[model samples]
Each structure stands twice: as C-alpha cells, then as structure tokens.
Target: MLFDLARPLLFLLDAEVAHELVLPSARLAHRFGLSGLPGGPLPGRQVNAMGLAFPNPVGLAAGFDKNAAFLRLFAAFGFGFLEIGTVTPRPQPGNPKPRLFRIAAARALINRMGFNNCGIARFVENVRRARYDGILGINIGKNAATPIERAADDYVACMQAVYPLASYIAVNISSPNTKDLRELQRGTALEGLLDALGRERRSLARKHNRRVPIAVKIAPDLEDDAIPAIAERFLAHEVDAIIATNATVSRAGLAGLPHADEAGGLTGAPLRARATEVVRRLAAALQGAIPIIGVGGILSGADALERIDAGASLVQLYTGLVYRGPALVREAVAAIEPQAARMAA
Candidate 1:
C-alpha cells in the first residue's frame, strides 16, 4: 500500500542503508503505539511442533531480527513466530557495508552479510528486554574467526547461553557467507556436531528440568540426493524440527534481474521455486519424522500455501517481507486463515 508507493524514495537510498533505516522507523512507530500486530484474531489455532506452541504457521526468519533487537516491534507485525540471531559466542561486525543489494526488477536481493551480530551476551540481554510473547527461537552460529574444525565449540557456547531463553534453538550450518559453514552440513561434520549438541540438550534439560526443541537450518543449493541424505541425518539424530532452507548461492531462476551477477546468496521471488522443492523433498523424505519450517521466498499467501501443500508444517519469510513491507505479513495471514479454519472445521 503506502510502502509500495513510497518505494521509489526508499529505493533511492543504498540497499543496506534502507535496511538499517527500517529498524529505527519501526521502533519509533512502536513508541507511538502505532506499531501493531495483525488486526484479526488468529483463531487461537495453536499447534505444537518442536515442543513449542506457535499461534500460527507464519514466522519471521532468522536474519530479520538478528540480535533480538526488535522482536517486540516485530510481534506487532503479524508473524506467528519470530526467530532471531545467527548470534555467535562473541559479536562480530559481519562482512562490510555494501554487502546487501537489491534487484528490484526481479524482486530479489543478494547479501553476504557474514553473520554480523552483537555477541551472544548482548543478544541474551536484548531478548530479556523485549516484550514479545510468541514463540522465539534463537539461531546460533560459530564465530568467523573460529576455524571450521573448532566451529562446534562456538555453537556449544551459544547453545549453553541462549538455551534458557529460546523456545527452540536453530543450528545455522548453511549460511553461504561463512567460508566453510556449509561444510558442517556434510555427513561426518553434521552428525558429529548434532551428536554433541544433542547430548548438551539432554544434559541441560535434565539439569534445568526444562525441555526445548533443537532445529537445523539448511541450504537450498543442494541436489535431490543431497536433500534426502540431510533429511535422513535429521531423523537419525532426533532433531525436533528443520528450517528447510537458508538463502542460496544459485542464480538459476533469476535470469533477467539486474545485479544477478553479484556473488552472494540469492533471495526473494527468484528463489521461491527451488526453495519449495527443497522443502517438498525434505518433507517426503522425513515422512513426518519431524516438523519442517519452510523458508526461502514466501511473499504471498499463495506462496505460503504452496510450501504447506509441499508438506511444510510452518512457513517463514525474509526477502519477501523486505520487498512488500509489514503489510505482507497481514496479507499472508489473511490468505491462509480461511484454509486453516476449513481444516479446523
């Protein structure tokens, strides 16, 4: 609506700068109470997956509210669940300023923002201060300075720190920005890492006497064989949930978009197809062994439904929200609510 109309002005600014601008503006709107959640009652359609009750199936993906800086404000934007951080044990300022780019013609973006986050301690502090009441999952990653061999240590440290705070924890082993992060998704690496984390989850649950689900976020660039192989591991390790994808390095679908040549993970309209296929493959392979949190290029209710039809238990958005603004969430919820109601009936 208004956001689309104002896009020309927003497009005038540098991509990263515009992204930085959105946060403060949203925060200000919060101060005036103009910051609001979706208008309609969400039907109390609570579903338990990964040991958490999500009010609905739509979620704000990990990168949007990194550092937990704005979950309270985001809760007002109509997402059923809000996942924040790719937080590492210590804070590091991602890649560099010009990292985020927009391909308006194709309705896409390319970013190599190497997990710039305000360390785990600050992330914990921020989450503690937020007033959000919905499901909050914290996404954890290893520090860039940490070698790929020792990455498990950073994940372990972050899990130990944010465990008590997160409703669930997501292990991000797929962000292409990191030099060898995706390597962790390999057979031996993924199994070893999850084994260690799984032990920690059990130990912490017993010690604190509280249970929380642990999910893995994966990349979209893999092949058919790769998808099922990963799914097999998830089931074997008893992972509670899987966020079907993170952004991809492939530009296969964005044939006409400008800036398509940029070297980074491709997200938005261009990514919708391949991402959903990944979800479908994973879902079929897992056979409901665990819930799948489908994310990639969801920009509409139809897009959301396609993922669900493909077997995604929940759907998430990132690049779509950026192109469409807060209204996108309301639209997606409105689009899905009727089907959800009919399913309930």
Candidate 2:
C-alpha cells in the first residue's frame, strides 16, 4: 500500500535520484520501528546452504545496498538473506551520470555504473556500524584500475577484510559494466582466479578458524557451450555456490523499447528467461555437486519458484524490488514454502 502510493511519485524523478531518495527514507522508517512493507517479515522455510542457514530463500541481491549502508532497513522488509557490494579495493566514481535507466513499459533497467563504491575500508566500516547479524553475503570485485591480470589480489584483499563479518563471500566477475571483467569467467583466467581464491580461503579458514563459503557470480550472456566448462571449473575449485547470473549485455527482447540499446547490462524482465536458462544449465552441469543462487529478472512468486524448479537453491531480487516493492519478498517466500516443505518431507 505504501509502495503503491509512492511508486508514481518515485517514478516521476530521475531513476537514480529516486533510488537515492528511497534508501534513506526507508532507513528512516525502519529506525522509527515502522514495518517497511505492508506486513513485517514473512514466514519462510529454513534453508541450509553454504553451511549457513537462511530464514528464507528470497534475498536482496548485490547492488541495492552496495555500500552496506542500509542493511537493517532491508532486513525489515523480510528478505531471507541480503547480499551487499561489488565494492572494490579502492573508492572510485562509477560511470558518468545518468548511468541507470528505467524502462517502465518493459519493467527493465540498463546500467553501466562501473563498480562505483566507497572502497573496502569504508564498506567494512559501514558493515561494522550496521551491526546486522543476518545471513549477509558480501560481494567483492576488482578495482576499475586494477589490471585484469591481477584481479585476484583485489578479491583476496576483500575476502580477508570481510570474512569475519560475512555469512558468505560472493566473487563478482560477471558485471558487464566492468571492462574485461567477464573474461575472468573463461579459460585460464577462470582457473587462476578460482585457484588463487581457493588458496586464500584455505589460509583464511585456518587463520579465522572458520570456513566462509565462496559463491561466484557469473554473467547470463555466456554461450551455451561455455556453461558446462564453467561449472566444471567451479566444481574442481570447490566453489561453495554459483550465483547463476549477473546482468546481461544482450538486448534480445527490447528491440524497440526506450534505453534498449544502452551499453550497460540489461536486467529485469528482459533477462528473466536467459538467467533461468543459465541456472538450468549450471544445474545440469553441477548435477547437485554445488548449489546455485539464482538471480536476474525475478519479479514475482512464480518467477522465484521457476528458478527453484530449475534447481536454484535460493533466489534473489534486485530489479524485481523496483517493480514489485517489498511485498514481492512475502510472495516469493509463500510460493517457495510449500516446495521447501515437500523437499523436507
């Protein structure tokens, strides 16, 4: 009800401006003890994955709270888990202004906002201040200026900084906005990255006396032939989970829509099928050896279930939240609860 009232007004402003306004306002609402959604947290079936338990399988994907500044506010809205960042080793202004675009008609978004973030130092500080003890996943990415060859260093640095705080660590090598970053998803680059991160995790586990799970986020734009090999690499490297997709560079269905040709990744409804297919492919390749966190274009209860049917152990929302409001979280949990029960049975 509140979101419906505010949707039209929010839609009235520039996309990024509306985004900036919404976060703080929502945080304020949370601070006042107001439920940010129509109801408070939804009842969900517990899920055990990555050696951590999730209250539900519906999560807010990375990018929404990139800096970890609004963890409590989002938690109030009933996500089973929350993933924050794509934060780098250093702060950097993202792509030039007007980087985010909303296509109301298609219920889609296109963004090339390079991994603009307050660097890992400030990001850690923000997380520490939030004191949020939920099942949090901290996503890390290489600095824009970091040469592609040395991206592993950035990932290791971030993992070391957040390992104690994160329920899991998500390695983001798939955002199309980062130049050549996607290359890390392929061939020897993929091997080296997994190997490096694997070595680091072993050392960190011994140092911290805890084994934090590592989930690799991939792009949805890969050729069909590439997925199995990617899955193979993940399995061989012992990746705890695979985030089945990041945004896509493809503009398949939005041929005539506004902002359809934007250079950045295309997300929301336009990428739904492709993202699910990627999950399906990963599932086939992984054959249950590894769990999958399905995301990209999930906008409703049915979409969430579809990802689960395709073998996603969990589902996440980003663009869906933009279109459906916090209510979508409840809807997704409701949709998945029965299936979860059946599985448990």
Candidate 3:
C-alpha cells in the first residue's frame, strides 16, 4: 500500500537517484520503529542449506547492499538472508552516471555499474557496524583495474577478509559489466581459480575454526552445453553452492524497448525464463550433489515457486523489489512455504 502510493513518485526521479534516496530513507523509518513501513513479517519455514539454517528461503541478492550499509533496513523487510557486496579489495567509482536504467513497461533493469563499491576495508567496517546476526552472505569481486589473469588473487584476498564474518561467501565471477571477468568462468580458468580459493578456504577454516561455505555465482549467458561441465567443476572443487546466475547480457525479448540495448546485465521479468532454465539445468547436472541459489525475474509468489520447481533450494529478489516493492518478499515466502512443507513431508 505504501509502496504503491510511492511508486509513481519514485518512478518520477532518475532510477539511480530514487535508489539512493530510498535506502537511507527506509533506514530512517526503520530506526524510528516504523516497522510497518517496509512490510510486516510473514510466516516462513526454515530451510537448511550450505550448512546454515535459513529462517526463510527468500533473500535479498547482492548488488542491492553493495556497501553493507543498510542491513537492518532490508532485514526488516523479512528476507530469510541478505547477500551484500560485490566489493573489491579497493574502492572504485564504477561506470559513469546514468548506468542504471528502468524498463518500466517490462519491469526490468539494465545496469553496468561496474562493481562500484567502497572497497573491502570500509565494507567490512560497515558490516561490523550493522551487527546483523541473520544469515549474511558476502559477495566479493575483483577490482575493475585488476588484470584478468590475476583475478584469483583478488578473490582469495576477499575470501580471507570476509570468511570470518560471512555466513557464506559468494564468489562472483559473472557480472558482465567487468571486462574479461566471465573468462574466469571457462575451463582451465575456472579450475585454477577454484583451486586457489579452495586452498584459501581450507586455511581460513582452520584459522577461524569454522569452515564458511563458498558459493560461486555464474552468468546466465552461457551455452546450454556449458552448464554440465561447469557443474562438474563445482562438484570437483567442492563448492558449497552455485548461484545459478548473475544478470544477463542478452536482450532477447526487449528488441524495441527503451534501454533495450544497454551494455550491461538485464534483469527482472525478462530474465525469468533464462535464469530458471539455468537452475533447471544445474539441478539436473548437480543431481542434488550441491545446492543452487536461484535468482532473477522473481516478481511474485508464483515466480518464486517457479524457481523452486526448477530445483532452486532458495530464491532471491532484486528487480522484483523495485517493481513490486517489499510486499514481494512476503508474497514469495508465503508462496514457497507449502512446497517447503511438502518437501519436509
């Protein structure tokens, strides 16, 4: 109701400006005990994955809270978990302004923000300040200036830094905004990168006396045949989970729409089929060997169930929150509870 009232006004501003305004404003509302401002909590069943118990299966994906500044604000919206960052070892301004575009007609978004973040140091400090004890997933990425060949070094550094703090660490090598980052997803590159991170995790586990799980995020723009092989690599490397997709570069159904030709990832309603297809394929390839975190195009309860039906152990909301507002989270949670119960039965 609140969001429906605010949508027209928010849509009146530039997409990025509206985004910058909302997070802080919402945080203020949360601080004032305006609990109903985000949305009242909905019932959710517990889901266990990656060795951690999720209060619910709906999560806020990374990129929303890149700096980890609004943890509690989003937590109040009732996500089972919140994944923050795509932060690098150092700060970056990201791509120039006007990078985030809204396709209102299609309920989708295109962004080439290029992982602009406050760097891991500030990110870690912010996370510490939030003191949020929910199931937190920290997503780490290499700096844009870093050479592609040495991306593993950046991932390792980020892994070590957030390992102790994260309920699970998400290794993001799939964002199309970064140059050559996707190359790391290929054969030898994937193996080499996983091998390095595997070594670091073993060490971090011993040092922290806790083995924090690592989930590798991949891009949706991959050959159908490529998924099985990628699944094989994940299984071989013992990756705790696979975030079936990041945003996509393909502009399949948006040929004549505004921002249809943007050079970054396309997410929201348009991404539903592709993202779910990837999850379906990963589920088939993984054959329950590893868990899959399905995201993209989940704008309603039915969309959430679609991902689950396709074998996503969990689903996440981003662009959906933009179009549907906070109510989407509760809707998704309510939609999936029966399925979760059936599975338990």
CA RMSD of each candidate after superposition: 2.3, 2.5, 2.5
Query: What are the models' TM-scores?
Result: 0.95, 0.96, 0.96
What candidate 3 gets wrong by more than 4 Å, as runs, is 35-42, 338-345
Q: Write the residue-wise lDDT of candidate 2 on 1-345 in tens digits.
A: 677789999999989999999889877776776644622345677789989888889898999998988888888878889999988999999999899999888899999899989999999999999888788999999998999999999999999999999999999999998889999999889899999999999999999999999999999989999999888988889899999789998888888888888789989998999999999999999888989999999998899999999999999999999998888888888889966533533
What lDDT, from 0 to 1, does candidate 3 have?
Answer: 0.90
Cα lDDT listed for each candidate: 0.84, 0.90, 0.90
Quantify how close model 3 is to the true structure by its C-alpha RMSD in Å: 2.5
User: Given candidate 3, what's the lDDT at residue 330?
Assistant: 78
Off by over 4 Å in 2: 36-41, 338-345
How many clashing pairs per prediction, in order? 2, 0, 0
lDDT for each residue of candidate 1 in 1-345, tens digit (9 for 90 to 100): 545665688899998898888787867867786655453325423567987777788888999888898876778776788889899999999997789899888888999999999999999999888856678889999999999989889999999999888899999999999999999998788888989998888999997899888999999987789888988888888889999789889888677667788878988888889889998898889898899999988888799879888998888889988888877776666566766644533
The ten-residue window of minimal lDDT in model 2 covers 34-43
Better of 1 and 3 by TM-score: 3
Candidate 2 at 249: error in angstroms? 0.5
RMSD of 2: 2.5
